[model samples]
Structure formats: structure tokens, C-alpha cells
Target: MGRQSPFLLQIGVFILFFILQAATMRDRIIGGREAKPHSRPYMASIQFKGKNICGGALVNRIWVMSAAHCFDNLRPESMQVVLGAHSVTAQEPSQQNFTVQASISHPNYNMETLENDIHLLKLNKAALVNDFVRKISLPKQGEDVTPRRKCIIAGWGDTTDFETHPKALMETNTEVVSRASCNSSWTGSISQHMVCATSPDNVKRGFCSGDSGAPLVCMNRAVGVVSFSSFRCANPRFPDVYTRVSEFISWMEDVMRSF
Candidate 1:
């Protein structure tokens, strides 16, 4: 048999890789659903260079709770939080922007494993409480958010895959999936540090790319931070994973108090 050209072998490998990625992504889309719109006064958009970078909830006048992935390799000076923004384009310059003084991602965070995906941002000045700007309550220690309970999620991420960026300030509803179901779908990688949520039938209710760092809040309490979605939205076999806020409460309080 004749030897294959080196360039031909490389091209064949690239094609195979592309096909595998596509197949994985397609599986996810078939399994997921669209998330519902949410309404909360405490949610804020974290922007960088005029782009919506992540979602955060006001925890106090000077601090916001978000996902550690939001600040991964990002500098404080590059970030700004927009409060009282009903929509990105409609934001009032005066009410929308605040400078960030510092950020602290969990010391044990592992990006590859998505472990401890939590972070806190310190605002340069206290946020003024108003009808549009308020603080979200954190769940008390050991409080459990039961599975299958309805919860709210909000973000500025893309409305769909084809959309390169996120829609301006949107909210959605999804139900917490059972740990059993989530674990089965997630295989052996799901951890106590993570939680899963999705809408029934995987119809019009799931997190999309860029929704990372937003909250999966339940009953007005902070429960989870939107983390990874299976390379596709609404994958039936895989639920959207979030960093369980309850698992990191002590760490959060310690960081906030130290600042």
C-alpha cells in the first residue's frame, strides 16, 4: 500500500475531531430546554470593556456574589458592575456602572474540574439601595434547597448558539433536578459542591453559554452560581451544573470579613 501524505493525515485527524465535537454538542441540544424569564431587583450585570461578562447578586453594599470563573485570569481594574440595569442598552450611565476594588476567587478552585467555582467582588463604593438595586439574602447554614423545587436564574448570556453574545439582562426559571438524576446524568464527576437544575421536557428552559456566573436562586435565597452546561443547552442526559452556594458559605463569609 502507498504511504499517506503527512498533510493528508493531519487533515483527516482534524475532520475526525470536528465530527466528534459536533456529535457531542448535538446530543446536548437534544436533551436541554429553554429557561424562563426571571425578575429580581438585586441582580446586576458585570461588564468588561462594554461587554456583559457575568451576572452577580448584591450580597451587601460593598460586595457581590458571583462565580469564580467570572474572574478567572481577569483583573479587577478590567471589571465594572452595573446595578439597576433593566436592560443593557437602556442602562442609565449614572445608575449602571461601579468600579471594582478587588476580587477573590476560592483558593481551592480547579478550573478543569470546575471545583469551588465561587468568587466575591468588592465594590469601590457602596451601592445605593433603591427599587431597582437591593441585596439578595443568603441561605442560612445547613439550609437545604430540596430537589425538583422551582428556582430562578438570570443572566446576560447569548439567547442561542448562533448569537455570538448575550441578550441584555434577561431572567429565566428552571427546577432543581434531583441529586440522583443529576448524578446519573453527570456520571461520576458530579460533586457535592455542585448542583443541577433544568425545566421539564428540556423545552424552552436551560442556561446557555455566557450565562456562567449568574445565580440559580431559590425562594429569594442564593443557592447556586451558573457554571458549566454540557457543551449544548438542554442536554437530556446532562443537567446544567452550578456551584452550590451552600457548600461554600463559610469560605464566602471568611473572604468577605477579611476584606
Candidate 2:
């Protein structure tokens, strides 16, 4: 069985409802620079009503990986996935849009702590594989992200809750923080199914509003899904948490096989 609904889950100081507001969502990379077009080919914009809602990773032609919390009160018909997109506001010829066919949130996902926070999105049709749009490789089962391993996160979430306008996709370099260190910041806030990442010294950068479900790529493999961060946005004191992909490989593969 699944956990209780978290549509009201307070996220990044923005009410969950506010983050899902319609109109359009833009690139919200805080303390990060604009990403070159297709530089991260597997990056995906999970849009709702043509507006960016969450970040996702194209794991295969027909599937995308994201945070389960993103689906709260969100219907598949109202959502679409944008591939090969650079600017959230501008549509490029390389961009391909697909209607979402289904959203499968993990049955055991916990709303309070965001455990098993991962989710899989099935597309109505297989994505077109090309230079600008491609699939990210998943980690082998039991694979682990070493502490302080450098990684990258990209997204089009809100720079601030009030900045609703879209901008070009932004990305930042971050590193895995030790579980013990991360736990110290949250104090029993993180679970075994999750991992944490933080920007380097004095950088004070991390995920923020509208960045949920973003991918945490390390060693050229998709290792985690952006789960949550400090409500204050990149507060260096609290590293952002992500759904550990390696821990859910069986669940992911099982879902794919069922499809």
C-alpha cells in the first residue's frame, strides 16, 4: 500500500500548491550557470499544462525517472515531457513533446520523509533517440556513490516562488555528502533509501522550488532523483536529499518489465 498524500507537503518554503501553479516554469538553477543545449541529453522537463513542474531523467525510450512527490494531485493527462529542451520558455526544433500515458509512484513511498520517493513515467510513445535527446544509463544494482563524488544537477524550477517566468536550463556541480554528515544536519530526517549532495565549500548551493524530481548524475550514470532540499533553498547547512537509484533498481526493472 502507498503512504498518505502529501499534496500539502511543505517544500522549499513554497506551499506545495504554489509550486504546482499553472502558467509556465522556467530554468531555476541557483548559484549555477546556464547549461549548453543538449549538454545533458538525458535531462527532461516534466511539464504540466505546458509549464515546467518537475525535473526528470530519460532512462529509456518510453520511461522517465522522477520523484514520486511530483505526482501529488497531478494527473497524467495534464502533464507532458519535454526532451532536448534548453530554454524552458522557448521551443526548439530539437525539442520533442510527449503526452504522459501513466505515472507510477512507488507503492511504499513515504510522504513524511519521502522514502522510496522515486517514480516512473510512461510516455504515450517512445521518445525519438537523437543527438540532443538520449537515455541516461542506470547504475548497476548494489552500485554506490562514493562520498564527495562529484555530480551534476539540472532543472527549470523556480529561481524563487515569485519568479514565474521561464529561463534557460541551469546546472551546477555538486558532490555527495557523507550520510553521517547529512544526517547530522537533519537529525533522523534521511533514510537508508536516500542519499544527500551538497555544493563544494562556501558555495552554499543545492536544489530549490520547482526542482523536484531532478536527476543527480554521477560517473555518467543516473544515481539519484532530486527529492527535497532546505525550505530556504541552497542553505549550505542542509544538503539536499535524493532517492537512491541503486536501492530501487529491482523495483524500477520490475515496473519496466510489467510494461
Candidate 3:
């Protein structure tokens, strides 16, 4: 789950619904099953004061990608990234913890509209890659996920609305929703910078609170960053929205190179 920044400013009436929706988003993988231990090596548990607050993907040995909203009002010094984690609550031997040397949110990020919600965290030290810890591949610049494509979302979020977060990672399969359909459902608030997905069988199975900043893995590539969902979460009427990572490939490359 993620916290809404206090800097949320009014953009327009059309965007107001999204602004309010974002305020209540916590980010979880609803209706997902437990992931196999060490199966998602790239998954990163973003923590603050040793508490899991958000999820992320290890894109490189030194760089972790997440949602910009997750770091709002949070300091880098207090943040940590735990890689190779299957059970976030366990003191697993394979888990590698790293201090966040820096937290960089996209320059053009908008707290109100939830646009450009991508973020990156630089690790204090390079990760030691191994069988249970490795980086995931990134999408090509400007690459777009086609409608109806199936993708997997994994995180340490609750599987049900009332259930407490499980110790093991959870994941679910979702199908990409077309921009037009998603925009219609959201009243034209869906932007090109974002992507939408829903359960293939129309089940209420998608992201909810606590899964923010988690990667939407498609074709073995990290294609989207969990942004926000309806306040009701996993509601069929409102599909989950994500920051289209391909749209910010250039920005991410620049940040990694300059920093």
C-alpha cells in the first residue's frame, strides 16, 4: 500500500475522481495465490523503519524501481530495500538488505493526477547477484503492452480485503485492458502514460492496498509500476491503473547514468 502525498493539488474536475481514489489506495495483490519461495528474485520489499511499506523491482544491481507516491514525505536514510525475499516477515538467510543511498521520483510527477508515478532507489552498495537474487529485464524504450496480454503482479500484500498480509509473496494473473475501455470506465482519466488491467474472468482479482510500487511483469519484463486502484479495490467496474514504465525509459536511463 502507498500513502498519498499532502501536496496533492487540484488539476481539474475530470481528474478529481482519480485524486480521491489515489488518496485511499494502499496497494495489495487481491485474490492472488502464494508465490513459490525465491521464485521472484527481483521482487524488492521497500521498508521504512523495518516495516514493509511498499513493493519494488530490482532493475539492476544498484537500482530499484518503484512508484513515486511511495516515497512522498519519506526520507532515503530511513528507507531500506530487501531483495531475494520470499517471506517478508521472516529473517531469511537469502535476503539481502541495503540502505537507500538516494530516492529519486520522476521530475514531472504529479501528486494530484498521479501522473509519472515512477520512482527509483539507489542502493548504498551493489547487490551480490546469486541464484536467489537477480535483476529483472526492462522493457525496450517506448515499447507498449498490447491489449488482452496476460501479466503477473507479485507483492507482499493481502490476498483478501480482510486478511492480514501473508508472510510469503502473492501473485495473480491479469489481462491488459485497452486504453479506450479503461478510459471509458474511468471517465477519460486514463492517460497514455498509464496502463490498465483487470482479471480475465471478470473476477475481483487485482492489486489493492500494500502492493503499490510493485512491478507488473509481462513477457518476463517489468512493464508497469503499480499506481492506484479504486477505493473498493479489485472492483470489476474499475480496473487497476499503473504507470507505463516504457513511457519513462529515457528518464530512468538518464537518472541512472547521471546519478
Candidate 4:
């Protein structure tokens, strides 16, 4: 259910079959369920004008992390970040909102292959951190873990294809798979910059359309940034792809410190 970014996707099959995928409407969760309010405090709802556009996270008081595609060609002045929120459309008393001052996506971001699909949003002012508005810890640079580890992904994206997305945040448990396994399943579709995760037994428990740029949290650390699911969401063999967060730690530190 991943849409082609305005940027080019260099893969041949993606280019040849891109039109077919584009015709489908953005989809969402299949077997994932509702999440508790404020449970994922660092969660940030990236909005354009007044509508939710993507999921992001507060890495620090004034910096947000999300997929570059979500912000590509979008004006920062028209964007906002909503923290401490469970519902995408609702405004809550406990939530803190901030106007985006600016944003920068990875220099090498490729829409075609979804390589380096990360970005950072700078908030005009530091958010007032509180019980429900704290930042999530990031993984150490170059961190590595064996596959089959369990992780959780949360978002306000759809719960099923063609259905209205839930107002409340939805979450699902997914397992990390080895790159070799992922590559074999997609056959040249997996990129080095991407990490893979999915549900076992073909259960409909995976990220879907509108779930892009969401956080993939493991062991209380932000391990990956939701990149995109393949042509379909929650498919048994085609796991969801993510921008590995650990690999970008150096870039993130440099970006935050520079600006």
C-alpha cells in the first residue's frame, strides 16, 4: 500500500508496475488493534493544514523524525506536530502542538527504492515536556540485533483496507526478519538501508497504507522508522520495510547539532 514518492524509484519492476499500485487508494491496518492513550508519548502526528498526513516521533524537545516522503515538496509553514495525542483528528487538553520551523530530508533519499527514507522536522519552539509528552530514547549508533525479535508499531492509520482510519492510535506486534529472508521474499527489492518486520502465520498484523513514517519501537528504543509496505499490506511473505534508525544515528546527531 505504499505510494510512489514524487522522487524517482530506480527499480525496474517498480517503474514498470508503478501505475497499477498508484490506482489503489491508501489503505491501513488489517489485524492490528487499538492502542492505549499516551502509551506512546513520543508519537507525533504530522499534519498538513488541518489534516493528518504522517506519523513521526519527538527525538528531542524541538526535533521530530519521520519519513522524508511525507514532507517532500510540502511547505513547512503549512505543517504542524501534535504531541501527546492518541486520536489523529481530536484536539486534547493534554496535547501540545507546535508549528514547524523547517525540515530536511536525507540528502540521498530515493523515492523509487525508499532508501534513506528518513527526515527531521524542526519545531519553532521546544515543546513543554510532561508526563504525556516525553521523548523516546533512540537506539545507539550501529546497534544490531538478531532477527525474530518482537517490536511494536503504532499509528492512527487505517485498521483495514478501504475502511475509515481509526481516530485513536492503533498498534500491532511484529517480528523482525533477517535481511536474507526479506531479500529472498522480495527478490532484489530489499535495500541495505531497509529493515524488515512482519507477523507470523500470515496473520493480518502489520503496517499498511497511511502507516508510513510511523515508529517501530523495540525494547523501549526507537529502532526503525516506517518506510513502506510492499504492493500490499500485511501480506505473509512480503514484510513491511523500515528505515533502520540505528544506521542514521550519526546523521541525526549531526543534523540536530548543526541546526
Candidate 5:
């Protein structure tokens, strides 16, 4: 067909390249750096069959908090929690692995919509509090993080869509996006139960797959739990979503106290 118009062919090639680049960057730890070894003492690698599948935070001596979706169609007995780990592959002396005693997902949690995504795991035994292992404090009941407030999220998730999960923990700075702005961005899909954060200046940074349940630490308190993000992990158009920890403070306390 007349050699298919060289100009049109060039445009098609450019479009294809752009699409491929976007896909490659999706679900990645773009713009993040390796976390200081053992700096996030409360970070937990929620593993299934010895492979880290999600990130969690040690909330108390025996209670680890994560996303309920991380346990969907999964058994608590098959799960293991690794605390004080800098690298998931390394047999660090500070690491302490625990078998899950019970997995308590919010009763109202919806698997389809991922609402009430927060979850708690009870360890078979209490974790020893030491220099390398400790618990992070939870946010106060009804406490809300304001827009532009600085925060951090760390995980061992993939650095790119096609890459394997990172051996070492990685983290990046984030800023809370206003509920209104976030909701608008997501076409009102963001509920009051969720909080949104993104990198400053529209940079690519935030959680990706396998980072589910990672804590969003603000002011040294876990204010949110990683719930979901855009298909492009670092997409500036959509912010990362987390289950607002403050919204479920009562439920969490009740569960922890009961078990």
C-alpha cells in the first residue's frame, strides 16, 4: 500500500515504544533507594511457603498488621512472618521468623473491592524486642494525615514490572494527597477508609506488587496500610492507596485484645 507512508510508520514506532516503556515501569519501585539496614525494625516480610509475598509491620509483641488481600485464598498456617530482616535472601542474625497463630481479617473486608483491606496476624509466640526487632506505634484513633504531609513506605517488591522482588528492602519519600484530590483522580473510587500518597513533584515513587500491607509511616506512626496502586506503580497520574489505619483503630485494638 504505497510502502505504508514512512512518516506514519515512524509515528507508529514511537507510539509502540512509549507503550512498552510504560508497561515496563508499571508495578515497580521506581525512584526509591535501598533502606538503611535494620532501620525499619518493625518491617515484616509476610511469606508464604518461605517466599516473601507481602510486607507487614509489627504492631505489638505478637501482632503483625498487613493487608487482608495478602491472605486471600491463603491459609494462616502456611504463612510465616519474618521480622528484623534487611534482605529477604540473607540469613541475617537479626531476623526472627514466626509461624502465624491466627490471621484476623476485618469482618467487613471485601475481597472483590478490597475494602477494609487491613489484617492482623497473631504469632505463635511473642517476638523478642531487641536492637534489631521492635514494634511500630499505630496512629491515634481518628487521627488523619493532612495533605502534603511527609511520609515513607518501604518494601521488598519489584523495582520494575518484569523484575524479581528486591533482596534488600527499599523505601522512598512520599507526601499525603488530599482525600478530595485523590478521590477525584480515581473517579471517586477512593473511599474514606483509604488514604492516598505520591511522590513530590510528580516523581515516580511508591509501593508496587508484593508491597501490599506495608505501613505508610507518618510522624513515626503507621497511619495507613498499603492496599493498592495504579497499574503503573510510579504513575504520576494516580497516587498509591492505603487502608487508612486510623479508620480501623477500634477494630484493630479489639482484635489484638481479644487474641
Candidate 6:
């Protein structure tokens, strides 16, 4: 029997369809460095039907960063974000979990072109900041995170295609790839608003499915959000694409102020 039931599979497929159509990426890969519990308190897990559907990061007291595709046909109230948690299954009473109050997909989001793949979530209440819960700083305006800059991607995604979702958080260090290289690898589908990263030495150490919306952080600032990948997982020729956070500072600031 599958880990997810038939009904869950249907919902998962439906949700994943939007994820695919919007981002054109495969699932996430696990087994890297372990994320520091305090480094990513805003990091969250999105659960549906007893299975993790996606990953997200807290932007503010009530806002989270995630891919728009993850919200396909799903309402804000139906989702919950488990924050301040090191592992998804950790039953620590100290974990701060919040119900979603509202979800706003980017107005210019295009499923076909995968443009504006970002989304914001409003929490019912403010998340308490503790040892395991702290907000990650957003990249400054006009900040440029170029190729070869070391960054980290973290999630509770699968270790491999045939494997089930990981029970704990995992992270890996990767370097940003150049725009020219990214364009070449993605066959010209790359955009100025998107960035790419790959593992060193062409190793299979990058984001996969179920990692959508997780942060691509560097220098204690969030630079990108995991958006898409090739079907083969972390192939050297296919760099993982992410929504460039620095380019969307205005949109993010505007949305956050409304809360």
C-alpha cells in the first residue's frame, strides 16, 4: 500500500499539477547538512491529507513564502504551517503551529510561463519568536546574488524519487550558476527574475519536489525560493530554478504592510 491513500493521491496529483504547470519542477532531494534549528525558524511544512505537500518560509509575523502552484484549488483555511520545528514528526509541545488565514497568489502569476511563482500566506496569529523560531532577513533591494556564491537549500522533501517524504529537515550547500549557464541548461526558458543553483562537481545535491517555496538562503539573507527542477531530479545540466527574492522586494513589502 502507498503511504498516501487513493483520495489523498487524487488531491496530491491535483495540487502537484498546478505545481508542475506553474514551476515545471520535480520533487526535492534529502540527505545533506542538517539545518540549524534557529537559522530558519520561519521555515514551515505544509500538510494535506496526512502528507506533506510543500515547504515554505515565514516572511513576517503572518506571511510566508511559497510557490503559487502549491495553493492550486486549495483554500487558505485548509492549510496549516508547522513552524519552529526541527522535524515534522517532532511532538515537542513548544512547536508553534499556525492555521492559515489568507492566501494571496501573485497577480501576475502565469502557470504556463512559470512567471511570478511566488505566493504569500497570512497567519491567524503572530508566530512567537523563540530559539527555534526566528525570521530570516529578506535580501536588500537591488542586491545581486551571482553565480558561485554559496547558498543553502533546506526542506523535508524526499531523498530520492521512489522514496517517501523525509521525517526530518535536511539542508545542502550549493552555488549559484551564471545566467548564461542557467539559460543554456534550461534551454532559454530562464528569466531575469529567476535564478539557478547546482551542486558542486555536478553532484546530485539540489532541490527536488515537495521543496517548493523553501528558501535559497545565503549570508543570512533569503535570496530565492525553490520553484522548479527537471524531471530527472538534480541533473548537472538542469539547474534548479527559483524566484528571485531581491526582485520582488516591493511586492513583498507591500503585502506584508497590509497585514
Most accurate candidate by TM-score: 3
Question: Candidate 2's residue-wise lDDT over 186-235, tens digit each?
Answer: 99788778889988875856676337888899999989998877756677
Candidate 6: lDDT over CA atoms?
Answer: 0.79
Model 4 regions lying over 4 Å from their true place: 1-27
**Root-mean-square deviation per candidate:** 4.4, 7.9, 7.9, 7.3, 4.0, 7.3
lDDT of each: 0.74, 0.83, 0.89, 0.83, 0.86, 0.79
Candidate 4 per-residue lDDT over residues 1-259, each given as its tens digit: 9888655655756776656554443435568778887888999988877777788889999999999878767898889889988787777898888898879999999977788999999999999898889898998888864699999988877676554668788888999999999999888787767889999656878876447788889899889898877666788778888899999999999999999
Query: Model 2 off-target regions past 4 Å?
Result: 1-27, 161-166
Per-residue lDDT tens digits for candidate 1, residues 79-153, read 889887766656464364788998999999998888889889999999988777888998875566788889877
Task: For candidate 5, write residues 166-211 as lDDT tens digits.
Answer: 7699999999999899988889888889999999888777776438
Show the lowest summed lDDT stretch of 10 residues, model 4. Answer: 20-29
lDDT of 6 by residue, 1-259 (tens): 6477899889989988766654534446544766666456768887775456788888777788888878878887788888877778767665787888889888898877778888888888998877787778898866779789998888888766655556678888888999899998788988888888888777788877448888888888889888888776777788888888888889888887886
- List, residue by residue over 110-221, the lDDT tens digit for candidate 3: 9888999999999999999998999999988889999999999999876665546687999999999999999998899899999999999988898884498999999999
lDDT preference between candidates 1 and 4, better one: 4
Name the 10 consecutive residues with the lowest summed lDDT in model 5.
21-30
Q: After superposition, how far is residue 216 of candidate 1 from its true place, in Å?
A: 0.7
TM-score to native of every candidate shown = 0.84, 0.87, 0.89, 0.89, 0.89, 0.86
Error of 6 at 189 (Å): 0.9
Can you rank all candidates by lDDT, best first? 3, 5, 2, 4, 6, 1
- TM-score result, candidate 3: 0.89
